[model samples]
Target chain A: MADAVSTPQEIETELRKVLSYLTGNADLIHADANKPFKELGIDSMMAIEIMAALEKELKIQLQERDLAKFTSIKETVETLLTYVR
Target chain B: MQALKLNKHEILKHVPHRPPFLFIDRVVDLRPGKSIQALFYLDPAADYFQGHFPNHHVMPGSLMLEALAQATCVLFDITYPSKRKRRFYAGSVKARFLKVVQPGCELELNSKVISMVSKGGVYDVWASINGMDVLRGEMGCMCVYE
Candidate 1:
């Protein structure tokens, strides 16, 4: 099993890898955690890529509908905590 | 039943997607309710190539998923020929694009059904060009009559 991410900070650290891979620019993902992914220039397709990476790397199966609900890194981290924590 | 082969024209009978939008080219092998293998020759003259990336010309990952989903539709129809009347739409997709597909490439697509409910089903799919993994993951969808 993957290491449990008990805190929001840990989730952010892990998610950075996914974002970096999706956008193909590690520097561009340095925005505030509270900033929405759309605001970070993540389109619908990129969002799906992130979701798939999360499921594959973290083994968390997030419902497709719930992806839109967690628009920001903070929101996503919190939701992911419920599964991995 | 054993795997069956289908040519391009026969592919049209199983899927409704037409030219420009249709991503699959030929069915190499298929075992209804189990798995499928198909081919798609990515034409360099495709319109999307001009816009997706004029210089780099990378095939969009979303379209790759669509190709996989379309192959699953073929599998669904072959599995239950009577249900060919149903229209299937891509509901969920979870895939990873491991390689960049350029124009003039011949993609070999493979799909396997993981589960199926009343009107919904799940499939694990993958694609390759010359024996290299390009994309792979799971897809799900529900069907309705047109």
Candidate 2:
């Protein structure tokens, strides 16, 4: 099995990769990690896409409830760290 | 996938979803406990299209998955008739929508039962239009006995 996300830095890097791809690089530089995803132009569809991509790359399956709880990059990384295996 | 066969009336006997919500239109071919090929004719008149996108209308990916789930339920119904009344709740889904399905497109959906638990099952599902894959994924559902 693959190692789970163990550190905040690791989680942020992973999130950045996903967010960059979903929101496009033009907006990535201006994105505030603490702001809600909506402010960063990440819609529900993009959020789902990011989750799918992360699940595949991380080899981890996240629950639907977990998806509902993380609305910002900071919250997402924090939540991911809690479940990082 | 074969031509048209089982109609919505027949499918309704198995699944609980109704008009405007039921995404399945017909069952092309099905092998009990094995696999199923179904169809959904995306009607522009459907309510979802009215708001899904005002300008560029496209069927929701989540609903497409629901269509697959309904088809899986039909397979389970034929495979395990005794458990027909059990409500199968989608437990998890790992899906990717490769193409945007628009109104008036006929969706060809196919699914195969990959695993079965005492009260649930997992299905490998794919959806296509004109022989091009639009979506594919793995979905699991658990049975809730009433």
Per-candidate TM-score against the hidden true structure: 0.62, 0.61
CAPRI-wise, candidate 1 is: incorrect
Q: What overall lDDT goes with each candidate model?
A: 0.79, 0.77
For every prediction, compared with the true complex, DockQ reads: 0.05, 0.03
Off by over 4 Å in 1: A1-85
lDDT (Cα, tens digit) per residue for candidate 2, span A1-85: 2356568887777778778865666566446889998887775545555665667656677665666656998898877876774
DockQ of candidate 1 compared with the true complex: 0.05
Evaluate residue B65 in candidate 2 and report its C-alpha lDDT on the 0 to 100 scale.
95
* Whole-model alpha-carbon lDDT for candidate 2: 0.77
Q: Model 1 TM-score?
A: 0.62
Name the regions of candidate 2 deviating beyond 4 angstroms: A1-85, B1-5
